[model samples]
Target: MSDPLLDVENLRVSFATRTGIIEAVRGISFTLGRERLGIVGESGSGKSMTGRAILRLIRPPGRVEADHITMHGEDILAASEARMRQLRGGRVSMIMQDPKFSLNPVMTVGQQLIDSLRAHEKLARSECRQRAIAMLDEVAIRDPERVMGLYPHEVSGGMGQRIMIAMMLLPGPEILIADEPTSALDVSVQLQVLDIMDQLVKNRGMGLIFISHDLNLVAKFCDRIAVMYAGRIVECCKASELHKAQHPYTLGLLNAVPDLEHPRPRLEVLQRDPAWREALSVSARS
Candidate 1:
């Protein structure tokens, strides 16, 4: 890849609890070019935390440490809060797992979209509205003008996700961190949402960090795959080569998925090893 869009080294996220410090992410490193990089793991494997830590969204009591986190060669770990605010939704945008919690309940879809755009760029109200509608159309929302006036609750789960994608892409960010954006939708809608995101990312030449638990979905959508286990990346490989991943944890994850064509009598139960947790994380760069 010609000069990666984002780079990180030895990134770690931890929290202080009554028992002790619980590490959510431990010394994980990766690079993202203008291509899709998928992070897949079971729940509590730090897939979401890795995304949040990249954007410095982890709050107090949750400490993020790293050798470095850089975007376009600029050190993210050293950026100030104000700079980070500029980066979020401007240079970099994040789509949360659920729009129900991420979207402002009090605001209409139009209002939220306009506000998000205005936060990143100086534009007239009419222009912002026009741009917002155009973005909504781009994401394949039907009758975007009318849809804009509707509250988030009024839209279906799939439409809500498309709206979120439109809102995030409205600012023309170079990178997008999507955390399980289609988890709430039906299988059909999930594919539609993924198609929209894939098209947008390719059209914009943007680097995408796709965080999800679906191995099949990730394999189909991403250019590269990083299999995380116990808060660390156990295997990194080309998405097309994921089935051939060597790590036991990676093989376990693949085996855990049910195949309809070659139906198994019962889904294989994932057997965990204590050593996987203690093993060093594999670098996903390049």
Candidate 2:
């Protein structure tokens, strides 16, 4: 088979604290192809850090170390800041958790989307506007022309998230790092956003890194699931087989989820194990 779209090895992220150095992402490794790969863990388990480190988004006082982070044979770590700028939205786009904080409060939706596209592509102003509206339509936004004139605050939460997705995809990136993209939306809106993302990824043949805390949601949406704990991935498996995961940490996570059909008196609490932190991260490269 051909090479994977992206490959990461021995990736670590750390921050300098007054006490000492604190590691957020402990030497985890994974690969992305033209498929959805889910990284599921509790908050502060380094899911977001891993995603940012891949794009070298972690700024100083914090450090990103990796043996290699390659995209199509080029090492992302070795790329210059200018090259990274070219890669960030042009080749790899990220949809942050909340659109409110991510979108510029001063800009209209149309300006942000058009600017994002212009940053990566040399298109005429008219062409950029047309593409932006078309992308909005692609994400199922009705009356794109009207929506474009509206600012971020004017749109509902669901529409804001959809606009963010549309803005990210306007660059035609080969990889998308979506960090809790639907966390802020209602359940129905979450499904709508996920369906939009799912269709887009399949249609564009892009690699997707879906970082989420919802284990059941990830299991349903992703092709494979990487169970992370204490900054390490303890288990990796096909999403369909997540129920059969062997790691104690993975089992604990699974047991903690509430099932509607099999209602239990109480959900199981995850008992933490110190050894899991010291264990090597499971590779999610298959």
Candidate 3:
């Protein structure tokens, strides 16, 4: 394999609290190529924080310190605000958990997407409108022309999510960080949404950082899985081999997930140990 598309070494994020300094994301390192990488953990386990740090989206009071965050050999951590703005939706984009929260209610879906397109490149208004409609159609949204005229509230949750995907992908970003994109959608729509994302990732050959708490979903979708505990990754392995993870934390998480085919009397509760956070190790499995 060649060098990674994105590389991270000793990335950390912390916040200043009244009591003391709180380290939300400890020293964690990983690299991403043109493939899917899943960061799976419970809430407050820092999976979402890791994604935010990658994009430099962590705001004030919450600090982001990284030894290096290189994207295609350029240091993103050191990039100026202007350069960061250009890179944000143009070079690397993120699809948030819910479209309702991420999309602007005031703007029509078409206008929002057109704004993104125009931000990244110069084009005629008609051209941008055409491209926006085309992008919506690509996400499996029927009647895209009508959709282009409708407000965010007029669309269903699934449609809203697809519109957001269309907007984020219109720029043809090199890397995508999806933070539990399908969590808020219906079970039927979940697979539909995932299929759209998977197809787009494959078609674009983009590096994907999929952040989710669902071990089973990530295992099924990602090539590599990084299991995170409190503020750090405890293990890294091939998604198919997650069931055979070596770390105690990984084992506990795997045991906690309910098996649908065969029901257990009681799901196992995860027992946390203080020593698990002492040293972070990357156990890469073939």
Listed in order, each prediction's TM-score against the native is 0.98, 0.98, 0.97
lDDT of 3 by residue, 74-128 (tens): 9998999899999999989999998899989999888898999999999998999
Q: What is the C-alpha lDDT of each candidate?
A: 0.93, 0.93, 0.89
Write the number of the candidate with greater lDDT, choosing between 1 and 3: 1
Candidate 1's residue-wise lDDT over 10-81, tens digit each?
999999999999999999999999999999999999999999999999998999999999899999999999
Model 2 / residue 232 / CA error / Å: 0.9
Candidate 1 lDDT for residue 240 = 95
Question: Any runs in candidate 3 off by more than 4 Å, and if so which?
Answer: 283-286
Task: Give the C-alpha miss distance for residue 134 in model 1, angstroms.
Answer: 0.2
Instruction: Output the TM-score of candidate 1.
Output: 0.98
Instruction: Output the lDDT of residue 132, model 3.
Output: 93
Off by over 4 Å in 2: none
lDDT of 2 by residue, 131-250 (tens): 999999999999999999998989999999999999999989999999999999999999999999999999999999999989999999999999888788889999999989999988
Give the least accurate 10-residue stretch of model 3, judged by summed lDDT.
277-286
Colliding residue pairs in candidate 1: none
